[model samples]
Target: MEQMNYSFSVCSSELDYDAYLAFLLENYAHIRLPYPFPVTLSFLASPLLMGEAAFLICNEDNQVIGAFSYIRGTGERQYEDRHIVQIQVACIAEEHRCTRLFLYALQYFTQYLAHGEEQVQEFRFFAPSDDSLRRLFSKISSLTASLETDSGPLDEYRASFSEWQSYASQFRQTALFNS
Candidate 1:
């Protein structure tokens, strides 16, 4: 089957947060915390004041199909001051998960990071142990797994900016051949 193509964008005030919240509740309710939907909307609507931002993957009609949020920060005084991009949450519609949407999202995110004011030294995220997410990420960079937690036994993964570039290159090649 031909995969549906999507355009990427940063969440903006003009976009309908109610629709986004409904979609999230319908598809990723398991990941939701006790926080009210308004809180989530507020966070997404805010500027990148706390070194954080959210991106959306949308269809031609501008309907959001996938979303991910990330936070960047320098380590504490005891640890080396390394720039880190930690993916706080990521979700894609079940149908879109089989497509190249996730890869495209990652590519878009890498480009965003590259053009940002601060240099990103590393990317970090906790992915469920049983999921293929870690494997997909490995295509972009080497990952060292950390101990598991109650949240479906997550494994933390880290990668460098150069690794993201390599992944983007591979994604382009694969996408071209497939097309």
Candidate 2:
């Protein structure tokens, strides 16, 4: 199969915020409570306002197909001592779920972190303790056992830059062959 090309852009006022918000609502609004409300434009734009970045993934025609956001945490707490980039959310359009678009978005995001100004020491996120998610993330780094938090039971995953590079390389090879 040929590689499916996708483009990524940081959400900015210059782009169509309304369309982006609509796309997010269409794809992710089903996620309820304790999860940050994603149905509103304000909520979707909050990450950009908070000095973090939100990226929109688009296909050849520039249609919004997926998105993700990350924020650098202030190392005030014990668990946050390292320079961490917490992946706030990652959502793909239903039709694009099993496609390489998801992996492409992740690859782009990881490359951004590896080469960007943040110099992130660790990447972190809370995900359900499920086989698929674990398999996907484990490609990049080792994960901690599921731990209970105020929100709910979520497994915490963290990866250093070196670890990410290793995974990125492997992902690239897999993508290359699969393409």
Candidate 3:
């Protein structure tokens, strides 16, 4: 199957940040979250004040489509070998989602950290309303990991090279590896 091509850029400017947060609030029901959709500026401003990288995804037409906020944590802060790269907000524009724009932003983020950190061994999505979000994640083969929801298991797919390598070795026994 051919991957749909999309032109996108990652940004962190104030305008992009605000736009990204708005997109999240508009689409929060679809993405699934634990709490009521957050107030945009306050949600982002508090995190920005703490000094973490905020990422925005834009499409070919230069409209902001998605946003993901992540924070790095060392071994066993929560789970085994799973370094916490908390995904605070993640949403793809309703029209451009199938273009895999959110994945593009995630890919850029992984590479962006490669030069410094260990490139994030694993990522966790601990949403309050993950049930609504699992369907979209189920489409990506790499995103198979899940946590238990009231319904069943919520997806928690791999978004890092190391986790991919480990999964490949333990399960597929395929030589394919990242990094």
| Regions more than 4 Å wrong, model 1 | 1-3, 14-21, 29-51, 74-82, 150-152, 173-179
Q: lDDT of each structure?
A: 0.64, 0.67, 0.53
- Local error of candidate 1 at residue 104 (angstroms): 1.6
Candidate order by TM-score, highest to lowest?
Answer: 2, 1, 3
For model 2, residues 38-105, the per-residue Cα lDDT tens digits are: 42344466566676788888888899988777767743674354378777667787776763666566
TM-score of each: 0.72, 0.75, 0.59
For 32-144, candidate 3 gives per-residue lDDT tens digits of: 54333344334444446645566666655666666666555533553234355655566676776653445455455555555445445566554432544556554433554
Total residue pair clashes for candidate 3: 4
What's the residue-level lDDT of 166 in candidate 2? 66
Q: Which regions of candidate 2 are displaced past 4 Å? A: 14-17, 29-45, 74-82, 149-152, 171-179
Question: Which model scores highest in TM-score?
Answer: 2
Query: Candidate 3 versus the native: TM-score?
Result: 0.59
Model 3 Cα RMSD, Å?
6.8
The better candidate by lDDT, 1 or 3, is 1
- Between candidates 1 and 3, name the one with more favorable TM-score: 1
